[model samples]
Target: MTLDTKKNAFIELGKFLSQFSEKDTIKKKDIVENDLGPLNPTLSQVFFEEFQNLIHLSQSHNGWYTPEQVYFSVQSWSEALTEDNLNQWVGAYDLSAVQPKNIALILAGNIPLVGFHDFLSVLIAGHNVLVKTSSNDQHLLPFLSKCIIAIEPKFANKITFVEGKLENFDAVIATGSNNSARYFDYYFKDKPSIIRKNRNSIAVLNGQETTEQLAALGEDIFRYFGLGCRNVSKIFVPKGYSFVPFFEAIFKYQDVIHYEKYANNYDYNKAVFLMSNFKLLDNGFLTLKEDASYGSPISSVFYEFYENLPDLQTRLQSEGEQIQCIVSNNLVENSIPFGQTQQPKLGDYADNVDTIRFLITIK
Candidate 1:
């Protein structure tokens, strides 16, 4: 299939996804266009209904995949998969003379549809993809693949989901923890690959942040229950920084404690911290611990006191590999704005590795 054909297919898939969100699922009557023309109405309705069922069924398949979280993910992708966004993202690459290769994708299931960007990247670059879905997030992407195939049957030849061991792929893109990344490194050593290890996002605070910015920062923390690499797992504060304003700003998210899994984590992590005599600041739902680590457990955020901005910037730059995003009021260079980490654009490549540039260059 041509690049335009693949782009239009994904655009249609995005339109189909646009119908569902946390608030409601409403099907539009606009006929989806592919290279061949408009999709059949009956076929469109079938895919729409199937997606609705998948949204509810996702929670049963994985407790962490609550409908609201799933909907948030769906809505984010829907907003991203537009014509302008696609053109802007891919326009930089010269894909005209590319030779199609079989690209393997080993996805992480930390959040809903976490690996969809890699999937989209492979196809948009005119390559076939062999996907191994993480057991924690098995259903959503395959169903979306079906929608893409329905929109453009040629995609059927370009996409494959391996149920057993992965084989017959020229290169690989895998996301996993630090331990698993070691295994991927050893196994895929001979092949050209991108092996991603665990990373965490953090925020830097000078103690002058507004309630609005802090509250928005709460979205960065609590969204997806803090499972995504983009989630702000830690924050940097000045030596005498106060937690009162931060706590008050994030209090609106207290409802998260109502979820049994998160509450269990809160109770368990809090007990562990107390047993070790670690001082913690608690607000009934979330906890703040003065730990130097970047990766924090669920329901808690690690914080460290910084001596100065220059030193902190140098420190963070030195530890860049372990960090995904730095959320600040532009205090640090190239830091993402508060609350925008989770809403990454199409070009926001994970690990700052250019996936498209990697894909098109593969021999």
Candidate 2:
């Protein structure tokens, strides 16, 4: 199919998704009556109702996929899949004469619809996609794929979900932990590939942040239950920095402790820390531990003392591969602001790797 056809299909998909959110699930009149041309009104209603059910049912399939988090993911994508955003993201590339190739994707289920970017990239680059959905996030993407097909039937030929081994693919894009990345690298060594490994985000605090910014940081830490790679898993604080203001600001999110899954993680991780005789600063809901590691366990955030910004920059540069995003209040260059790490734009490719460029340049 043509690029315009694919773009229009996704734009329609975005409109469909915009109808559902945590605040409300109002069906828009334009979508039901005007926008979906080839798709009959009855079929549109079926998709609308089924998607609402799937958003709630996703929690049963994976406890981390709470309706609130799922709705946030849906809303983020819906806002992103606009005509202007799509044009700005893809307009930089020349895809008119590209040869279509089969691109295989092995997705990670740590967050809701985490692999949608790769799926969208492959298709928008005029290539066929073979997807292997992570068991933890099996339903959402496929359901949306059906919506895309309904809008533009041409996509039906370009998308495939594999149950067994992936074959006949020219390239691969796989996201997993560090150990699984090793396997992907070796197995796909002969093919053009992008193998993503585990990486965590960190926040830098100079002890001068406002209560509002600190509270916003809570969203960066707690959204998606801290499972996403972009979540702030650690923090950097100046020496003598106290946790009083930070703790007070994030108190609004204490409701997270009521969730059984998160509460279990909090209890288990805290017990292990205490049994190991490690000192911890605890709120009723979250824990803060002083450690050198970037990857912290769920319900806890690892922190370290920074002597100065220059030295911290040097250290972060040296350990860049292990970090995904640096959350700060304009203290560091190119650092994402508080509460915005999870709201990456279409161009904010994971690992800073250019996915669309990789797809179109494949021979």
Clashing pairs in 1: none
Candidate 1, 102: how far from true, in Å? 0.7
**Model 1 ranges with Cα > 4 A deviation:** 31-44
Candidate 2: clashing pairs of residues: none
The weakest ten consecutive residues by lDDT in model 1 span 31-40
Residue-wise C-alpha lDDT for candidate 2, range 2-89, written one tens digit per residue? 8898999899888888999999889888773224456465665676788999999999999999999999999999999999999999
lDDT of 1 by residue, 19-84 (tens): 888787777777462222354545555666778889999989999999999999999999999999
lDDT winner = 2
Best by TM-score: 2
Give the Å shift of residue 114 in candidate 2: 0.2
Quality of model 2 by C-alpha lDDT: 0.93
**Cα miss at 301, model 2 (Å)?**
0.2
What lDDT score belongs to each candidate, Candidate 1 first? 0.92, 0.93
